[model samples]
Target: MLSDTSGGTSGFQWHVSGEGPTDNGVGSPQPEEEESASGVSDRRAKVTVIVLCYINLLNYMDRFTVAGVLPDIEQFFSISDGKSGLLQTVFICSYMFLAPLFGYLGDRCNRKSIMCVGIFFWSLVTLASSFIGKEHFWALLLTRGLVGVGEASYSTIAPTIIADLFVKETRTNMLSIFYFAIPVGSGMGYIVGSKVNDVAGDWHWALRVRLQHQTSHSECFFSELNVSLYFPLHFCCSPSFILSTFGFTTVAFVTGSLALWAPAFLFRAGVFTGEKQPCLKVPCDNSDSVIFGIITVVTGILGVASGVQASKKLRTRTSRADPLVCAAGLLLAAPFLYLSIMFAQASTVATYVFIFLGETFLSMNWAVVADMLLYVVIPTRRSTAEAFQIVLSHLLGDAISPYLIGVVSDSIKKSDSYMWEFRSLQMSLLLCSFVAVVGGAFFLATALFIEQDRHLAENYVPSGE
Candidate 1:
């Protein structure tokens, strides 16, 4: 193996290269004690999944903690909802823009180091939330933006590592397991922040506030430079898929971002408040929570079962890659997403049902994209590709959609009625839907154009140039 350390940093070079042993797309080469490699495969997958899940969980927690405490923040800082929403916008804006830079770096650097440094930085900034004053608004925004840097680093590199480790057949299932971090982490962040505020009666929800107050300025300065490290040994494996999977998956990704913002747009316009509870709503007692739990359980079962089916389905494929099915899933999902956002305010029951349908369809992408990336990029460039994918997805996708929706909402704010403003938001989904439609077509074309190997042809490189 020709390990590429050319992209790594001084004194922190990594020995790992993204390429597998085979020059042809036969299979990942294994060690001599690997006649039966299933045991090692299971171990690698489980460990990688666990660590990636933890990274994702922490990533979402730091990302959405502000959203959870937005009301308290508004009350304490005397900021309006519109302005507070800018916090999210700022975070996402920096996140989207920096993703490419980070991707470029991750491609040429040690990803584990990047991930660790990023986690520490963001976690510290999250802690710094306790120290800053209301007048230092720009400082807070800067912290949020820096947090974006850390997040961009993790989200970009983690999946790439997963893909490098896993084979194509299991990549979707592996990625799905990784993505489970989103709902769990977001839900937990909200739960933690809301409950802590309720119990402590502190308008300031900073975990490090008391410590910050006690620490001297010099001490604080020193603490900020401290770095944390976590590097795991061994690698996981991913199954491969066709190029069509990547194209279709990306299309699904773009539309799904818009679908995610639909409800929030309605909430912002005050068109459908549903019922605003006190900030202290309990996770177990709340009706939404109960329903969410049932949904989670059912979805968990379905996801596992689907993964099982997919793995089985792969065995029967003459071509060994099921990208057609992947394309169909995305095509099916776009319409449901469009309908969900378009009709969310029709009725409470309708809103909830549609939103669930939207999310259910959107969730399928976790599997598809993982499989696509695992198969598409060679092991050495997987992280780079993943980072680029993140940059693309966020730069061209979610990062812009919310801000665009916000812009549309504000543009129509002076209209005679709020309904007109909401209509503008609704219209934006057409743009989202169109992207999905075009992306789907591109994906289908790419799928057809891809060669018969389970792994993408572009990945195979003969040795010893």
Candidate 2:
């Protein structure tokens, strides 16, 4: 493996290069593991990327699938806004809490084995959740939480694997392609979930349908026996990691709230405008959901690609390019979100247009943030760094956003008027735009530390400095 070690780093640079950074500038060079004597390193890396993307796509799809059929679930279970919100809350609670455990295991264990175990349980549990009777909504929530255990196992580890495979601009391109799945999967969650539920005349089938995708996501083929034997380190305290994760937290909050409630909000807006009627029965109109899904998919592709390209171009001139792009994305997303919220009652078309713009810009943060984390943290601590980032982001971000938004909306709805539902949700959603500005500020602050942090990670020594 060839490396530029002007820093005289101790540990091999795993994320930036080979298994780790060159040791004391005297590490023996090898032919990049010679494909592990199976002709599988580079080809395998590409395959792994494709498989990981597939897994990510369906994972998000399964997540938002519940949101796609949310109204049906509400009517069938006779639940309140609080309970509906709890669906997301419990899942994120489990996911956020369990991430560190997986991060620990991922750094030490065979990555493929961990994901296989997770997918096994995730599949069985999801299949069973789909059959719960209406009176057993708690069982459904329990199952959703269980599902998180499996997702956490994979989500926390996959990116580090990618970081292990590629470096520099190639890693950015791969990440853009990788993160592209998020919106596409989220949109499919809504589209496939709604259409399936409508066709099956039952929301339960959406869960079952997601299983079809899940059964095929177990193609991992990576190991880390020689990667690191040192005990996993705690989260890096670098300002870049902190600020970027905080910035990403806001993105999570906004996206989480929207994923769980946007369709319902749009439906209520139509009822308030008298363009649509209140749900008189099961399987409510899902036109709003389909439209929103299409918008999400389109914006995700555009945002990730554009953000990556913009950062790549700017990086030639400034080392702070990544954080600046992230800052610009969140800052630009705020005003359009505000407009979307304000226009929902007056004109659906206008609201959709604004949402299109806001979400497109918002989408820019995904790939860029992930790429930033890989570069700004050393390879050995990458998994642990990823763990804490997930914890912090979810702890402050999506974990509570959905439930909090629901509670606020419920508190404001003192009347039986359906219009109150729309109005309250609208008011609560304004928080997203405000949070967006705060996130942008965090990213801007990150620019001050990004270059310094990248240098430190590049030359980082695990211990015994």
Candidate 3:
């Protein structure tokens, strides 16, 4: 029942019937308030955004919590930098591959049900990961990888739902709010995980504490297991979507590296400067994770907020405002990132200030990029578009960055000396600056075709029900 397009739709499949959006003109409508106007009431839309944001927050928080306790886990498992990097790589790989199926279902299924099932799976895996023995490090990796199924389901579906609920400025604002979870949840993961570790004197507690919301589990894991027997592979010809995703991939690369390594790098910097001791034992200093997490939260808020405001204002002057703003953000971030890396060995204050500036600019793309994707594609394809973006970005971006940095660091380090460790990681991270510049260039190129793609999407109509 799935077939290819004969015209300009590129990778879009012919519309499928019998399973259109349940939230829209299908079956019994929702309540008067829930389906009030334009099939989505203002109150209901706001509530939906709030709920999605909460789920998003929990998702990111669960993900980065491991980073918060990386030192403890490393000590407990006795792993090398490359093996340490595998933790993130495995999770991302699973997430990336599972996204397409989730994307395909999101377009034709009940989005809420899909997300609930996904989250529940994630929670169960997380609960199990906490009980794993130190000797069973592979088990921990397996659970982390499985957790991706739930995340991929939610992530691929949520933004498209937001796109359906609102239009123009309202959608941009809501998307911005939803993306705040990226930084906030991420920061909380680090802050909460490390604090829990300190209190329980075991890294396992970090995973256990997230289960405080286990009541939400039954709603999470269903989407991951849904049978999509023949998922049609699709593509987008929109240059704006393609280029913006390339730019966003760089953001993922930089952020993923920083998320796992920034805290460790800072701790190592302290040791190199004679300000702190090397983590010779378990539960070593997580203060760096805490501090870096704080920076990530604060800068992320400022970055997303300012980028949205700037794009909103710039829209008055240019049709390509979103991509232009995205370009400016990454281009400006490159130098600050370089400064942050170079300053780490010298002044901690200088390193932090530069990191703040760098991350703030880097964060500017989160909501703007999503908004760009929503506008450049029609509603039905948004989920699939989101999935493609995620796969490409993570496959080329964060999925490899953490491991690549670790492998590069391991290759260059001549010994187990603290200085070599610090030097090796620092040098590997410097690659982020160049990557940022390349991302900016992609966004700059996106600006050229943004208007054309948006025009096509604006006039698009589904060939069937």
Extract clashing residue pairs from model 2: 11-21, 12-20, 12-21, 13-20, 13-21
TM-score of each: 0.69, 0.91, 0.89
Worst 10 residues of 3 by lDDT: 222-231
The residue-by-residue lDDT of candidate 3 on 1-465, one tens digit each, is: 232232322233444334334565768644443342124456766777887888888889999999999989989999988988999999999999999899988766666677777877888889999999989999999999999998998899888777766778888999999999999899999999999999888999999897767446445321111112232232266778888899899999989998888888888899999999878787788998888889989998999999999999999999999999999999999999999999999899999999999999999999999999988877657788899999999999999999998899999999999999899999999999999999999999999999988888888754534
In every candidate, how many clashes are there?
A: 16, 5, 12
The alpha-carbon deviation from the true structure for residue 264 of candidate 2, after best TM-score superposition, in angstroms, is 0.5
lDDT of 3: 0.84
Better of 1 and 2 by lDDT: 2
* Clash count, candidate 2: 5
lDDT of candidates 1 onward, in order: 0.52, 0.85, 0.84
Candidate 2 lDDT trough over 10 residues, lowest sum: 4-13
Error of 3 at 6 (Å): 27
User: Residue by residue across 72-106, what tens digits does model 2's lDDT show?
Assistant: 89889988887899999899999999999998877
Candidate 1 lDDT over residue span 1-465, tens digit each? 322233334222235345446747677664533211122344644665676777676666555555555555655565543465467667777876777676666656556666667666666676776667878877777777777876886787677655544555466566777777765655554455545656666635634332232222112111001111221111112223334433544553453343234324434334434343333222212234323333433443353345335635764863433455455545665676577556655655665565455445444445655665555555555554565556555555555554565565556555635465456556655565556566556556655544434343444653452
